[model samples]
Target chain A: MSSMVHHFPILLVAIPILAAAITMMLRSKPKLQTGFSVLASFSLVPISFILLMNVWNSGIQVYEVGEWGKYGIMLVADLLSAGMVMLSSFVSFLSLIYSLDYIEKRSLSTYHPLFNLLIAGLHGSFLTGDIFNLFVFFEVLLLSSCGLVVALEKDGVTKSTDKLEATFKYLVLNMLGSILMLIAVASLYATTGTLNMADISVKLSAMQAAGNLPWHVFAIGLLFIVVFGNKAAIFPLHYWLPDVHPTAPSPISAMLSGVLIKVGVYGMLRVFFFIFTDLHDMFQPIIIVLALLTIGIGAVSAVAQTDVKRLLAYSSVSQIGYVFLGIGFGSLGAIAASLVYLVNHAIAKSLLFLTSGGIIHHAGTRDMNKMGGMVNSSPFMATAFLIGSMSIAGLPPMGGFISKFTLFDAGIMGQYYKEITIALLFAIFSLFYMFRAWLLMFWGEKRDVKRYGEYSEHSISPMIYMPIMILALMVLILGVYAEPLLSIAQATAVQILNPQAYIDTVLTRVVR
Target chain B: MNNTLLSLTISILFGIGTFLILRRDIVKVIIGLSILSHAVNLLIVSVGAFSGKDVPIITHDEVASTNTIFIDSLINGIFAPMLNGTNPTQYVDPLVQALVLTAIVISLATTAMIIILAYRIHEEYGTTDIHKLKRLWG
Candidate 1:
C-alpha cells in the first residue's frame, strides 16, 4: 500500500554497501569505524523486521530495479526471503558486535569493511530475484568470506597456513560450484527466455502445461543441487566446510556456520519451490535421501572431532540436514518446520561459535582434550556455552527442542516414517556430541600446565560475552514462547507452497 | 550445425578444465578454474547464439537462419516481434551479452584473488602442491 515499502528490498542490500564504504573510509579512526559499522549493522535489524512485517501484512513486495519491469533485475521479498534476510541481518549485527573485541586491533581497518561486504552479499543473495544477480551475490559472499578467512589474524590454534589451506579448498570447490551454476542458469535462460525469476516461473509453468518441457530443464534443476548444495555444505559437496569454517577468526566462523551455508538452502528453496514447482515429484525423493546421509555423516564426523571448532562445524552439517529433511518433505507443516529449525540453528549455532571463541581465548587451545575444567575460569562463558549446547542438542527448554520436535512431527504427519526414524537417531547423535564437547572442555581437571603447556590468562571482555548472552537469551525465549515464531514460519510455508502469489506480485499484470 | 560446433567446443573446454583441476599442482588448478570459467562464459554466449538472429558473426544473409528453436516465434513475428518480444532484426539477444559481461567480470575478480591466494599459500607452505596443503583436514 505504501511506496516506501516498495523500496525496502533494495534498501536492505544498499544500506549495507553504503555502510561498508563509509566504514572503509573511517578506517583511520579505529573507534569511529567500529562504532559506525556497529551502528549500521544494528540499524538493519529494525528495517528487516519492518520488511518482514510488511510482507506478512500485504502480500509479496517486488522492487523493479531501473524500472525495466520483467526484463531487468528485480528484488522480491516474499515471506521466505524476508524471513531469511531478517535472520541474517540479526545474526550479522550480533556477530559484528562480537567481532569488535575478538578481532585483532591492528586488523580492524580491513575487518569492518570486509565484514560489511559479507553482510551485503548475504542480504543480496537472499533478496535478489534475478537468477544472474544471485550468481553475482554468491561471488560477493565467496570473496569476502575467503578474504576474512585468509587475511584475518586468527587465534593461536589456527595457524597462518591453516587459514590459507582452508581458503584455498573453499575457493576451488566454490569455483567449481560457480561454473556449474552458470551452466544451469544459462541453459535455463536458453530454454525459458527470461532471467527474472517470476517471469521465468510463468514461462516454465506454461512450457510444462503445454507438455513440451525440455529435458535440459530437468537437468538444470538437479544441477542446482550441486550449486546450492555446495553453498549449504550438504552431503557429497560438503568437503570444504569443516576445514574452512573452523580456521576463520571466531566471529567470522559464526557467520559462516550460522548463515552463509544456509545460502545454499535458500537457493534450493527459491529455485526449486518457486520456479521448478512442476518438478517437485522428481526432486523430492532425491533431496530426502541425500539429506538423510548428510545427517548421518555429519553426526559421525562430529562425534570423532576433538578440536572444539571443528566439532561445531561438523555439527552444523548435521543440523542443516535436519532443516533439509523438513524441506524435502514438501508439506506445509514440513516446510514450516524447516523454517523453524533454520532459525533456531542459526541463533544457537552462532551463539555456540561465539562462546567457543571465548573458550579458545580463555584456554589458549582449540584441542578439546587440552582444555580441562574451565568452569571456574569463566563462569559466564561456562553458562553461555552450556545454554548454546543445550539449545543445539535439542534438549528441553531450548529453541532446538521445539524445532526438532516440529520437524519430526511434520515428517510423521507427511507419512515419512523411515526418514523420521533415521532423523531421530541423528538427533540423539547431536545431543551426544554437543554435551560431550561441553563436558570435555568445561568439566575435566583444569588445563594441565606441565602436560599441555600454560594457557594465556586474561579476563574475558564483556564485549565478547554479551552478544553470546543475548543470543542465548533469544534461544531461551524462543523455546519458552514459541507461538509467534511458529505462526510466522507457518505463514512463510504457506507462501512457499503457493507460488502463484509470488509470480503475480513480481510480474505485474501490466505486462500482459 | 553451428550450434553443434559451439556445444562441442564448450564440452571440450569443460573436459580440459576438469582434468586440470585433478592435477596436483595448485597453480595448474587455478589455471583449471580460469579455463572452466571461460568455458562457462562461452556456454552462456552459446546459449544466446542458439536464440540469436543470424547476425553478421554467424551469417550475412538477408533472411535469418531457420534452424534455431527461436524461429518459431517468427511464425507470429510481424504481430509481436517476440525475440524476448523485442526487435530481432535490429540485434541478436543483447541480454546474453550483458549476462556474459557480468559473469566475465565476476570470474576475473575471483580468478585474480585465487591466484594471489595460491602465491601466498606457496610463500607460507613452501609448496605449490595442493595435496601437501591439507593441514586443516584432521
Candidate 2:
C-alpha cells in the first residue's frame, strides 16, 4: 500500500479524468453518474492528503509519465503543489457536493462530467512539472469551465442569453491568453532549448553565469505575466471574470472565485520564484504596481455592484491582487504570508459564495436589493454568511483575519510600507463591501415573497448544507488553529525560495 | 533577410489579429483569435527556423548499435544517429514541432468551441455583434 503511494500524483489527475469519462458514459443514468462524481470527488481529498503527507515526510515526489524521464512529462508533487492540490480538491469536493442540489436538472446532464474534468485540470495544473503540460491543463480548465458556464441553473436568474454572452467573452479573451502563452513558452523553448521547467531554469542560469543570456528570454518571462495574469484575473486582464462569474451557477461561482484564479498566482510563483528567480528583482516593481491597480479597481468596482455574485466576483479580482502582492514582495515571509492569505481567502470566499448560493436560493434573485430579512427565514445561511463575511472582513476567529494580519505584517516587516498602506486601504474597502452586501441581504426589511416568490426549499438540501457547513468550519478552524498550515506554508516558502531542491529532484530521475 | 521578413510577417499578423479582435463583430473577433494563434504558431516555427542548421527529418539511422529502433517521442520517429550520444548537441526544431503541433490542436479545439459559442450567441441574441450581446451588465 505504501509502495503504491508514488502513483498518487498521477492518480490525483487521472482519477478525475477517468471519472469524467465514466460520468459521460453514464449520462442516461443520472443517479449513477452523480454517484460516481461524488465518489471521485470525495476520493481525491484522501489521495491529496496522503500525497501531502508523503511529500511532508518523504520530500518531493516526482512522477515521470511513461518512464521517459525528463524527456517525458513529469508531475512534481512538492509541498506547494501537494498543498495546493489538497486545497483545490477539498474545495472542489465540497463544491461538487453543493452542485448536487444547486444545478438544475437540465444542466445536470453535463455538469458532473465537466466538473470532474475541471477537477482533473486543476489537479494536473497543480502537479505537472513541464511548462507545456501546464498549458495543456490550463486549456482543459478553460474548456471545462466554459462548458459548465454555458449551462443553465435552477436559480432561474441566469438567462441562456447571458450564459452565451459571458461564455463568448470568456472564450475570446482566454483564446488570446492561450495564444500569448504559446508565444511565451515557444520563445522560452527557443531561448533555452527545453520545455521541462527545471531544465529551462538550469539552462537559463547557466547562460546567465556564462555571461550571454539573451534579453528576449526576460521578455518571454514578462509575457507570462499577461498569460498567467489573464488566468489569475489580475488587473488589465480581469474583465472576463466579473461577467463570467455571475452568469454561472452558484457552486461554479465558488470554484471560480475560490480556486481557479489562484492557479494564476500559482503559475506566477512557479515561473518567477522557481524558474525565473533572476527575473524577480526586475518583475517585483511591475507586479506590485499591477497588483495595486487590481486591488484598487476590484475593490472600487465591488463597492458599486448590485448583484451579490458580481460583487463576490469583483472581490475575487481584488483578493487575487493581494495574493499577487505577496508574490510581488519576493521575500520568504511575504510568500509564506501569501500562501496563508491564499488558503484563508480560498476557504472563506468559497464559503461566502456557497452561502451566496444559499442566499440566492432563499431570496430567489442574485440582486441584493431584492433580498431582505434573510436571517429570519434561514438562520443557518445567515450564520454562515456572517462567518464568511467576518472572515473576509479580517475579523478575528475567522481565517481571513489571520491571513490578512500576516499579509500586512509580512509587508511591514519587509518594509514595503507604501505598498502595504495602499493594500490596507483596499482591505478596508473590501471590509465595507463584504459586510454591506451581507447586511443589505440578511438584515433589512422582511422579504417580499409576494414579488420575488417563495424561497427555494432546494437550498436546504443536505447536499448543499454539507459543503457550506464544512467550508465554514474550515474557515473557523483555519483562524483558530493555523499552526499546521502555517508551518507547511513556511516550508513551502523555503522550497520556493530555493529552487535547487526542485531542480535536483526533477533532473536526477533515474531512467527505467 | 529571411529572418527579418519572417519577423515582419509575424508582427503584421499580430497587428491585424489585434485590430480585428477589437472590431464590434464577434466573428471578426474569432477570426482575430485564429490569426493570433497562427501568428504565434509561425513565430514558434520561426524560432526553430534558423538558417543553415541540419533540418532533422525522419531517417532510420544508427543509434546505440541499433538501426531499426524508433525514438520514444513519436510512434514512427526514426532514431537519428545525429541526435543522441554521438551528437554533442540538441536541435530546437523537433521540440518546436511538437510544441506547435500541440498548440495547433489546442487552438483548433478552442476555435471550434468559440465558433459554436458565437453561433449560439447569435442564435440567442439575434446578432453576431459583440456590442449587442451585453445582457450581463455589471
Candidate 3:
C-alpha cells in the first residue's frame, strides 16, 4: 500500500489519457463509450480523494517522471493541488453523467474522448512541477475545448457561426497568453537556471535574501499576471468568456464555468504565493484593483443580459472576482477564504448551468423573456434553480453565503476597507441580477403560445436532473456543515504560503 | 553583444505579431500566432546558450572518472567544482534544449489546431474578417 502511493499521482493523469484513447477506439458504439467514460470519470473521484488523504497523512508527494531527479519533469501534490483535484473530479464525474443524456448522439462519439482528454489536461496542469509542462497541458485544454465547442448537436439551436466566432476569439487571446507565458518561463530559466517550480522558488528566494535579484525577475512575475489573468478571465481579459462559455453545449458550459476558470485561480495562487513570495507587497494592490474591476464589470453586464446561460456566464466572472479579492488580501485566513469560495462557486455554478439545459430543452429557446411560469411545469427544476440562485446571491443557509461571509471577514481583518466596500456594493449587483434572472424565468405569466410556440411536452431526463439535484444538495450540505471543507481549505492555505516543505520534498527525494 | 542582438530581434518579432493579430483578416491572425511562437522558441534557445561550442553529451570515460573524482573530493574536504577551472566552451546547457523541444512540439500542435479552426471559421461565416463575425455581444 505504501508503494502504491508513489504511483497514485501518475495514475490520476494516466488513467484519463488511457481511457481517452480507448474511448476513441470505441467511438462507433456510443453506448459502450458512454459507459466507459462514466466509469472512468466516476473512478477518478475515489482516486483523487485517496490522493488527497495520502497528501494529508504524508507531506507533499513528488513523482519524478523518468527518475532523472529534479532535472526531469515532476508531479507534486500538496494540499492545494490534491484538494483541487478532488473538487475537479467530483464536478467532472457529475458533468459526464449529465452529458450522457444532454449531449446529442452525433456529438457523443467525439465528446467522450475529448472530455476525458480535458480531464487529463486539468489533472496534468494541477500536478506538474515543471512550468513548461503546465503550458503543454494548457494547450491540451485549449484544443480539446475548441473541438468540443463547435461539435454538432441534435437540436442545432446553437449556430455554427456563433461557435466559430467564439472559438476564434478564445483561441486568439489564449494563444497570446501562452506566448507571454513562454517568454516569462524562458527568461526565468535564463536567470535562475531551473524549470522545476520548487527549484525556482528556492533559487528566487535565495536571490532575494542576497539582495542580488534582477529587476527583470520582477517583470517576469508581472508577466504571469497576463498569462493567468487571461485564463481566469479577469476584467479586460474577460470579454471572451461571456461569449465563449454560453456558446458551448451546456455540459461543457458547466465544466468551463465550474472548474476551468479555477485553473487560472490555481495558477495565480501557485505562482504568486510560492514563486513570487518576495514581491507580495508589490503585487497586492495591483491585484486588488483588478479584482474590483472584474466584479463590477461582470455584475453590471450580467444585469443587461436577456439570455439565461449568458447571464450565468457573466455571473461566473463576478464570482471569480471575489476569489481574486481573497487572494489579493495576501493573508493565510484570506487565501483559505478564497479556496472556500472557489469550491462553493464550482458546485453552485455547475448546478445552475445543468438546470439551464433542462429549462432550454422545455422552452426551446435560450432567452429568459421566452421563459416564464416554468415552475408550474417543472417544480423540481425550479427548486434547483432557486437554490443555486440563492446560494450565488449569498443568502443564509446556502454555501455561497458562508463563502462570501468569510471573504468579507478576511478582507476586514486584512484592513482592506475601501476594496471590501466596493466588493460589497458589487455583491448587491450579484443578488439583483441573479434573482431577476431567476424570477424572469420561473415567475409571472408563461409566454404567449402564439409568439414563442408551445412549451415542449417531453419530460426532463432523470440522468440530467439527478446531477443538478446532487450538486444542489452539496451546496446545502456545504453551507450547513462547512467545518470539514473549511479545515481542508485552511490546510491548503498553509501549504501554499510556506513553500519550504514543497522545495525540500521535490529537491531531496532520491531518484528510484 | 550577441545577447543584445537576440533580444532586439525577439522584441521585433513580438511587435510584428501583435500588429498582425490586430488586423481584420483571420488568416493573418493565425500567421501572427505562428510568428509569435517561432520567436518564443528562439528566445528559449537563446536563454540556454552558455559560452559553449560542443553538444552536451558526456562521454562514458568522462562520466566514470568524474563520478569517482567527485566522491574522492567530497571525502578530502574539497567540493566537486566542475565550472571553476574547466573549459567553458566544451558543452552547452542541455536542459533548456530539452525545454525548447517540448515547447516546439506544443506550439506545433496548437498552431495546427488554430489553422484548422480558422479554416472552419471561414467556412462557417463565409468571411475571414473578425469585425464582421460579431453575432454575440452584450
- Taking candidate 2, what TM-score does its chain B reach relative to the real chain B? 0.74
Candidates, DockQ: 0.47, 0.46, 0.50
lDDT of 1: 0.86
Distance from true position, residue B30, model 2, in Å? 0.9
Q: Rank all candidate structures by their DockQ, best first, as comma-separated numbers.
A: 3, 1, 2
Give the Cα error of residue A286 in candidate 1, in Å: 0.7
- lDDT at residue A353 of model 3 (Cα atoms): 93
- Give the whole-model CA lDDT for all candidates, comma-separated: 0.86, 0.87, 0.87
Better of 1 and 3 by TM-score: 3
lDDT of 1 by residue, A1-512 (tens): 47877788998899889988998999899989998898889889998999999988988888878876666678889989999999999999998888888888887788988999999999999999999999999999999999888655435667878888888889989989999999999988888777888767877777787787888888999999989999998899887899988999998999999999899999998888988987877898889999999999999999999999999999999999999998899999999999999999999999999999998887778889888778877778889889989998998899999999999999999999999999999989999999999899889786666765655678767788789989999999999999999999999998888998988787663431
Q: What is the lDDT of residue A152 in candidate 1?
A: 57
How does model 3 do on interface RMSD, in angstroms?
A: 3.6
Per-residue lDDT of A136-194 in model 2, one digit per residue for the tens?
A: 99999999999998777777877888888888888877888888888888888777656
Task: Write candidate 3's Cα lDDT for A72-156 as tens digits.
Answer: 7899999999998999999999998888887788888999999999999999999999888898899888888888888765556
- For model 3, the stretches where C-alpha displacement exceeds 4 angstroms are B68-89
TM-score of the A-chain for all models: 0.98, 0.98, 0.98
lDDT of 2 by residue, B13-32 (tens): 99999999999998898898
lDDT of 1 at A110: 88
